[model samples]
Target: MTPPKLRRLATAGLIAALLAGPMQAAAAQEPLVDHTPGQADIEGGATAQQDTNSLDASLSDAEKTADSVLTVDQMAANQRALASEIGPDGSSLGQGIERLATTGDPQVAPVDADAPTGTAAVSYWRPSGVYGVDVSSHQETVDWRAARNQGSQFAYVKATEATGYINPFFSPQYGGSEAAGMLRGAYHFAIPNVSTGAQQANYFINNGGGWVNDGKTLPPLLDVEYNPYPSLGNSCYNMSAAQMVSWIRDFSNTVVTRTGRLPMIYTTTDWWNTCTGYSTAFADHPLHIANYNNSGAGTLPAGWTGYELWQYTSIGPVVGDWNQWPSTLSALQAFARNNTAPAPSAGSAAITTLAGRTTKLGGATSGVVCGLIGGGCYQNYQRGSIHWTATTGAHATLGAIRTTWAGTGYEKGRLGYPTGPETCGLLGSGCYQNFQRGTIHWTTATGAHATLGAIRTAWAAHGYEKGRLGYPTGAETCGLVGGGCYQNFQRGTIHWTSTTGAHATLGGIRNTWAGTGYENGRLGYPTGPEICGITDGGCYQDYQRGAIHWTTATGAHATLGAIRRAWAGTGYETGSLGFPAGPETCTLVGGGCYQSFQRGAIHWTTATGAHATTGAIRRAWAGTGYENGRLGYPTGPQTCGLVDGGCYQNYQRGAIHWTTATGAHATLGAIRSTWAGTGYERGRLGYPTGPETCANNRCTQTFQGGTLTWTPTTGTRITYK
Candidate 1:
């Protein structure tokens, strides 16, 4: 398919001038009086900002990459400027195809390393695989359903070309393929000498190359080959091997940020060797080698060990260039679904991120440059700077830490550079630097801080950003309680005392410590670090007073006083009970205090002291209405190992006995006196079967062997079972 623009009058004078002239930096003649969403600094570097040339200037998102662009007059002026330059009507995909057709240039590197060319006859003989077609504006109204009938499993539609022109038929061709139940994708034609690779890439994506993980949209393809406009520039577009590699890298990395998948490279081996100087940098990128031949995709370019697809011929089965996917159809569909959509590209990434601050940053000290450690790009300004990576997107770094980083040689510094923005939601409203050596945390209260070594290690142990401490608020401060130093975090604090070294005090344990007046209180400073991995996922931290226990179901709570002693005797968290569920509650019956655990609670009082009541006995006490009921707060811990595997705990008023056979039942008041006379669990009555029940003013307690009946009118009476 040929471009209609080819019919326009040819300028012989302009043709010679453009072909011989060195490429000058192109600028846009657009006003940059304001800011829009994704608009970055001008592509023509500092000169474009000065508006020196009447060329194009990228002022806003609309002017730069978005669909809405240039005023009618400005658009017409740009079209007029390039009126004679739209020479070749062919797509980049067909440059080598036509060249091989006429000149018999070798489609593949000759089997003999010294051979210069090969026959064109075998180049057009189609090879077998799952086939597909590629379309451009030339195939304007494609009957994609007809193409599907022709067994084209996938389709690649030309979305944009050279940063200026978008295929007018891109929508119907791209959409119609999917509508006809075929996989489809978008591709861009390279005019490397015309604009930056990022510019052309952004233009392509904004037009129709944007992808969704719909299992039908293939990875965006980059159609880079011999320059179709030989009258305008040479085959390699005047780019040296290094520049060409950098240009492709810039374009690819930009696409990765926009869509998670690395783009499929569509190029023939001959052009690749000529342009990239046989560079092996892009081995990871999937290759769609264009070697139109009856033989295998021969002598694949430098990097790729295998090809994903082979463009067998430019001659169309219908309306476009047809290619083959050697794998099964399901494999191709799986390929589409595998690369889920990633974060959308912010046009030029770092440049776009730094757009709003262009005025503040002044003019560019250098052009946008990439090929960093992680395929990131950066642009320097008179003040500050902006850096971008696929993982971190784009963020500007300034202030003291940035100055320090810059002084240490930017990315070559000890900490590498800030990977993200100086976000301020951290502890004490601080900021971060996710770097290599150590993070630099800052807060208004403590200026700036960069910590490594032991302090940072302690912070890391507490879970870094997601931990209880969260992001550090300020630098470590040495001084107070037990000659200790402490660093504050978002939610808690890490204290390093001479005695206990460094330990985190946060969450409920910290709250409990606060209640006791912290270090000044009974607990004093931590005696040892918090040790976790006790039974039932519990942790304990020792203090001068006692220790705090923590768990997922129960929060961190301190075990102190007499209740703490009783818990310790029972093996703390590993005892009959588990971690502390809630804080200690006081002012119960007789001014008693109690703290709940995973199993039960430890009740403390002046008379009953403290006793760990758990399991069946505790439930029996609860049934008897706790400390206020017939069976008051437990006076002794539950004791087991008796007849019938029975366990019992003595209360203020009576006792509750339990066995596997008889659940648990409290025998108190008159029943207690009667049961005691018969000897508890050893007499004829045995362990209590169930709780006492009252009806018609008569209360009866059933035992394992007999029944004990009592009432106000009638005294206690025992009946044998």
Candidate 2:
């Protein structure tokens, strides 16, 4: 029989895309097609003889690319790569590796009218081995139970092809078979000329070719057969035997280096011999040969003394390419677990970081595993664990600090990664570690704590350990009133509400706040930092409900509700009425409340609301029993700019008028009204000159313009001064 069955029909449209060379390879990749495999295969793997004349000029396209690495976006690009390399049968590329030993006109052996030439039925006597199947995207969803029912034991799913294309259906196909209790592995299809072998190997591993010590996951495989696209390039992908050998070695070595396992090489006999120059370098790697003869897998590749697996048929009895291992199920599993955890190498920095400290950390309980959120890695130990990232190096965390860190979601938490190791010798024997977010402090009394977010910033601004607030007493406690959070410290506490952010409270302000029940108090939480630039050496911190103004003379007190608003309107501590001197009290007749300030007091009632009374006018109102006597509460602010350089403040009943000569006085009853008939201060009576004198149940007052007298029987009579 002539060896080289002539090349024939291809999916012409698919092959035409290769004319643009590697650019097309790196361009938009096609996703895996979830469909049944097409019917076509030539014995030594040849194409069908139809459409031969039409592909004459197109078959000689020799596309090449620079061997430099690709600056690829692996995450987005790895989803798909349907290439010109896909064969007519879609799953079988071995046909392109068929031996080309023809001398006369190319000829194809005869087979069924519908089947591609050289297709033969399998012999009744099958090879004795653990059988399985290798599927690509074209197989879609394979019925693993059906395949396993056929006595198939394990499966290898195509993971990626070329540096550009990853089998999109990989997760379901690979995981589905495993979930069916079958040992599974991943494979990469090599397009060696497109990019360096190391790059493709990394892409494969990053996509799915990783290995765990689990017996259910098999070692990865490298499928390096013919180009499968003879129309695009030569059979060996436009490379000579020497270049092909170098490419195979690079791919094999990289896979070994990354996974710590020698990958199985799948190829056809004639292609392995012709393309690799029959190199013996990869004899250590298990070989999976592809042959489609009637009796058995035809011949061995040059390097491998014996074959480990076989892809026996493209027209699979079930869904995909049929595979068989010449060993039992247990032996196949044993190969998958070899050289599993190869991280933290003997001389590596991580190992050196833990050199003589195993006593403290205890023996390792887990391997150095990576692929962290920030590219960090960690190895667990009996007592503790060592965490490593490019920026943080390797550091061990254990005990309460580690427990607290774990409680915070580890590296994925608000603290992110640790920037430094735990440092002790702080006040009260406290220890702290700086992280991307903040710090976690631990002490014997406090146990362990984490200070984070705006709360941490407020603490740092105050002086941290040496400030009025010492080390944190506990982790930041959240979910308080109004979605607020607070953290207690050795000396005081810092509070954070969504609307207020964070602020520190210490000394008398804290005392009064604690007395009022802290966050649940009338003041709620502090909305801003304290300011001491007041009239006196006083400071004040504003809170949600009110404020606490502190001064050496008046101490600290909160003025809340309407009373506080009245004080704020009066220019706060810098105004006529100074800082608050006492907590607001509601013990008044008629359910009225009042807050005493440095200079005066502000009173509020259900009927009159809140108003401030200060200076000489306030004393005059106090003499009249304040809100209990004639004038109930001041209705307005103290008004100046009256006649004769005078000032007057209105009240619930009457007004208290003050001036340099008149001092301060109040007007009341009928005799005071008769003075108002003459326009009082602005009219003939002008300003009051003397207090109203009373005797024998009668009262009288002398003003600058006149004197008004009153009796029990008669009202008032005005006598001109």
Candidate 3:
């Protein structure tokens, strides 16, 4: 007949931490635990009895105080004050009594041993990559071999468009994909302008080889995107929720019966969520989601733990043009198997600058424009195409645009605007708009005609848009729905490779055939030749001292300083293992012992401790430094750090001379990261606040103000230095 009790038992340690105030909530909530007492309340009641005793004592005091109170309200106020001292958090005296009722005590209730235990579970998921191809005339040769060679694992070959029409690009690419050993499937970009689902299915079935070899390929996919054409059929873009579902179901079932694989659905994140009410319906089906980002920057569906695959990074360069391509094959397989899903792979991390870190701008201003072949300039808009409706925010400039000259007649060079896609090439042969936006336009004139510069569409994070090539690179490029290279071409000389390092070599010309790792240069020609075997080498080392020099194949040389230098002790003979007696002997003995080096320099301990010639040590250390700073071991020097409120090299300043600890005045440098992370200082000091002094390499004051606080040249200091 007793009311059910809910007693919460908390440990003394837990109580202490609880009173410490809120930090951060755990990642997930704990599961409910059962809390039912099975045994009689002997031990449990003991703690409750103590709380009851305390409550009684307090109540008795309140009663005695009330009995002597001058008025009822005054007595009540006193009672409230007394109750507050003994209450937990904001619990009122009445609330305490109510809570204590279940435990038969007024203090904290004993934790229930039978209460359900709370625990966390992890998500069981994996990611799969999906490869999508938008075939048109360019991919007629669909080389399955090339696709496989490039690591393509699955193919969603274009089948039809919205006019109940088949894309002319599909057959050859499909046949090529088949020939090249790629796992293939067909998809119809739903044509709302055409017939009903049954009619569309019939057209697809008849045109798509009768769906006879279903097992040979993946199930047919539905490529649903924005279908703006309203004339053929209004059904393409607008449909009731029920009608849309029914239509999809019908098309899917038809494909399933014919292909022997379950039909899949491919769509943009927005379309899937808004147009068809598919957010809930498609959860159980294989969905190929598209969110165009250089990395996964697009919105995604909620509760969409797994997807058949994802479309990421579409700006892949191949065959003289950019084609969208999947960043990985594993992501496709995982999606197909219903194991896991991935966001787009068009990674856009924060770019660290001397000014501090910043989020990437949404368009062309965010990318590094590149040059292309056949006498044209290429601009790689970090994202995708520039959507320049007059309403679109645009900054423009007057410039030459290549129409039909020099092959594709597009222009070359960095543009003065930032409106177009990541990459655009221009030719100067025909009439064209002579204006540029969203890029820096650079043009070159040759005799009768000039190469004009044009803006390309922005390169959205992971998405891509194909551009027509008057002259093709002969090789085809493919992308995930959002990832790929937009082919830009003007015929010159062609080589069959995806060497993003350099432009495609033209006609075996030595200048065109750059080698790999050297930023794709013409074959047999030295572009950025790296000399690694030299002493104290810079990325372009050219001289040899404490430093080394690099001579460009183009006949340019650059000098670089030695990364580090160490002196051998006096009394040591050149290349011999002994010490000198005096300073003069120290100079003489260590004359040849000046150890010039770079980071990661090493000397064999087995070798006798002798003063090797400084020249010899310099030579050995040349072009061998791999670390950023001196990480020398064996007795060269300790790590460099701040001393005397300044960065001291090689732990240069001794304890007395160096007044501050290593980290006291030194700062970590900014880093290029996609997410927030720790940074380091590359032997540079933060700006100074005021005049600071040091003598004999020692801090004059207990603190040096100059390097202590980073001050702004501006009147007021900014948020971050």
Candidate 1 Cα errors over 4 Å, as ranges: 1-446, 450-471, 475-483, 506-517, 530-538, 693-699, 711-715
Residue pairs in collision within model 1: 27-55, 27-56, 28-55, 28-56, 28-57, 29-55, 29-56, 29-57
Which candidate achieves the best TM-score against the true structure? 2
Relative to the unseen true structure, what is the C-alpha lDDT of residue 291 in candidate 2, on a scale of 0 to 100?
A: 76
Candidate ordering by TM-score (highest first) = 2, 1, 3
Candidate 3 lDDT tens digits, 488-589: 234232122122211222221222122221122112212222234332221222111211222122122211121122222221122222211111111222
Task: Locate the minimum summed-lDDT window of 10 residues in model 1.
Answer: 1-10
Of the candidates numbered 1 and 2, which has the greater TM-score value? 2
* lDDT tens readout by residue for model 2, 314-386: 5555664677788775567566667334444322367446635556788764445455566776666667777
Model 1 / residue 715 / CA error / Å: 4.3
CA displacement after TM-score superposition, residue 494 of candidate 2 (Å): 1.9
Q: Return the TM-score for each candidate structure.
A: 0.37, 0.54, 0.27
What are the lDDT figures for the candidates, one per model? 0.68, 0.69, 0.32
Error of 2 at 231 (Å): 58
The all-Cα superposition gives candidate 1 an RMSD in Å to the true structure of: 23.3
